[model samples]
Target: MEDITIHEFDFALINEFFTELERQGPGSPEETIRALGFIGNLSNKTKIADLGCGTGFQTMVLAQNTEAAITALDLCAGSIDKLNATAGKLGLQNRVKGIVGSMDNLPFQNEEFDLIWSEGAIASIGFEKGLNHWKRFLKKDGYIAVTYESWYTDERPAEIEKWWLDAVPEIGTIAHNISIMQKAGYIPVAAFTLPESCWIDNYFVPQKARQEEFLKQHAGNKTVEDMIAFMRHEADLYSKYKQYYGYVFYIGKKM
Candidate 1:
């Protein structure tokens, strides 16, 4: 059998799987709000771009809190469709628009936004590269907020570390990431680790029902089964070794 890793698959299956879930990764509305609180200078005229906004879960939270004109972009067409539908249903279609696009190759003009927000998705592009690339889209003093995987301690067991390195080789410690942010020309605003519930409660628990449905939908498919098994193993690993590493919200302001 081929060794199965989630990142190794073409995104077709991965995107299809995540489109069915409310969120693409480990994050909660409360944590979203907490990150928003650290940002300042928002008004009805603020322009925000939310890159890699899978189904716009955090996007909606941001739309509700601030009267900012938001362009939510994602590479997954299915996720963008769902997000647009949700925005219309919630009567926020005026301020929230979902666009299908790649994060690395953005569709916006230079220095066109007051803020750039990405939740649980900046890893698709390397952290430093993402910050530096996306910085051009932000106006002077604009803010960028993102949730990314990072190490909490200087050392960790080889198993989990190796697993993450294979998955996202650029993953680094919080301090290391903050330094990257500074070098990328942003002044670090705040950095905080997400609480455990965001993963177990908001992300994993919700996926239980979805996993069953996904398996049933793609019955007898070996690749799909391997993917599910890989996901479960990831949860198990997090359960066993969460203290060493997890997602952290990093906020910064353009210099």
Candidate 2:
């Protein structure tokens, strides 16, 4: 979701892997609307910021539903270019614009946005830090909707748990995240776990296909081989041990 530094060869392979997909993360437009439904009263006056908006898939969904101005920010210029082109084609050029930037150093002014949305990207700067850093950019009483990879249960396979611990920080149950939200100075409006279809259907299933294509194209490249192995490891792990952890969406309003 967020940026990860990788070898140049793996980087090329990965950029190719995701280039053709509408969504880079495991989310559907329907799920995005479901989260937006929790926030009431929308109008042209509303302004939104979508952090780490890979290719701006969800950004377009938001623009289509609301008359709000949205800035889709991402670290990848190629992603921003695709987002811009899509926004233009959808005739949402005035409402949606893609910015190439980092989430940690948001370029917008303090209290400028009415809503801040992030999907599977908060971990780039750590969840707690992301919340604290982004709050300044949101207006008073504005909402922030985000999804985080979380531990669903306390008891789990030690090996998988260790793998996740190394991959992401602040792995916790729903209640644990709710506590974190309160500590970050937001009042929860709604919370729910994303359905598994979000992963299997939207993400891994397509990712698997992409991997297959890469194997044929980059046949003997060690970089592609290592990259493919790592990517496959995630899907394989989830296939065997999905119940232990998953992404959960939390909607909160700034206090």
**Alpha-carbon RMSD to native, per candidate:** 1.2, 2.9
TM-score of 2: 0.93
Worst ten-residue run, lDDT, model 1?
1-10
Give the Cα lDDT of each candidate: 0.93, 0.86
Give lDDT tens digits, candidate 2, residues 124-225.
688888988999998889999999988888789987887777677467888888888889999999888888999999998888778888889989987787
Which candidate has the top score in TM-score?
1
> TM-scores for all candidates?
0.98, 0.93
Return the lDDT, model 1, position 154.
Answer: 96
lDDT of 1: 0.93
lDDT of the structure predicted as candidate 2: 0.86
| Candidate 1 collision pairs | none
Residue 69, candidate 2: alpha-carbon lDDT = 94
